[model samples]
Target: MPKEQLREAAEGLARQLERQHGVRSSWEGDCVRIKGAGVDGELSFAGGVVDVSVRLGLLASPFKGMLQAEVQRYLDEHVS
Candidate 1:
């Protein structure tokens, strides 16, 4: 996917996260910073590549796998 498209997809993901998990996000150039009760992360897109870094606090650690899956699903659905 191109950077623009990736950014759009990420924006969608951010909204979804906010609605579902009460997370909040903001953009800084090509990166989106995300935070919630037990999550903190940044999603960045550059040169048609997307990178996501998420840190789950102790209470959120157990949901790591689910978070990964949701992100993958979002990319799969929106990027292609």
Candidate 2:
């Protein structure tokens, strides 16, 4: 995808996360850094690829797979 489109998708994802999950996100260089409750992560888009790195707290670790799947679903629906 083009850079502008990717940026828009990232921003939309951030808004969805904040509204639905209470995860706050901010741009850090070319990546979006997110944190809230029991989660911390960074998302980067480059060369038409989206990369996600998440760190779940002890209380949230059990839901790691679920979270990843949700993110992947979001990307599949909106980022391509």
Candidate 3:
């Protein structure tokens, strides 16, 4: 996707995360750094690719794969 579209998608995702999961995000250069009760991560968009790295607390780790899959699904539905 184009850079502007990517930016819009990123912002939209951030808003959804905050609203639905109580997660918060801040821009750090080209990345969106995410933090919440049990998660910390960064979402970066570059070269038409989106990279996400998440670290979940012990209590939340068990759902890591599910979270990743959901995020991928959201991106697939919204960012393309």
Candidate 4:
């Protein structure tokens, strides 16, 4: 996706999640795409298995991780 699109998606995800708990943290994101990801990767996941297909571009990994963590922290603070 385009950078603007990805940022919008990330913000949208945050807004959707925040609605239930009123989280106020902002969201930031970069363009991400997976290489060599076949159709199988698009399929359903197996038990106890993770399927990370995002490939970051330009933005740092830690930045993304922090954004995710902040989201989770807000959830934990407000919900769990």
* Highest lDDT against the true fold, candidate: 1
Q: Higher-TM-score candidate among 1 and 3?
A: 1
**TM-score winner:** 1
lDDT against true structure, model 3: 0.86
> Model 4, range 1-80, lDDT digits (tens) per residue?
24344344444544654464343433222322222211111111233221233333453454557545754564345331
Candidate 4 stretches with Cα past 4 Å from truth are 27-80
Model with the higher lDDT, candidate 1 or 3? 1
lDDT of 2 by residue, 19-47 (tens): 98799999986799999999999889877
Name the lDDT of candidate 1: 0.91
Residue 26 shift from truth in candidate 3, angstroms: 0.3
Q: How many residue pairs clash in each candidate?
A: 0, 0, 0, 0
lDDT of 4 at 51: 26
Give the TM-score of each candidate.
Answer: 0.92, 0.89, 0.88, 0.32
Evaluate residue 14 in candidate 1 and report its C-alpha lDDT on the 0 to 100 scale.
95
Q: What is candidate 1's lDDT per residue for 1-80, written digit by digit as tens?
A: 67777888999999998998889999999999999999999998877778899999999999999999998998888987
* Cα-lDDT of candidate 4: 0.37
Q: Against the correct fold, how does model 3 do in TM-score?
A: 0.88
Residue clash pairs of candidate 3: none
Q: Weakest 10 consecutive residues, lDDT, candidate 2? A: 43-52
Q: How many angstroms is residue 34 displaced in model 4 relative to the true structure, after the best TM-score fit?
A: 25
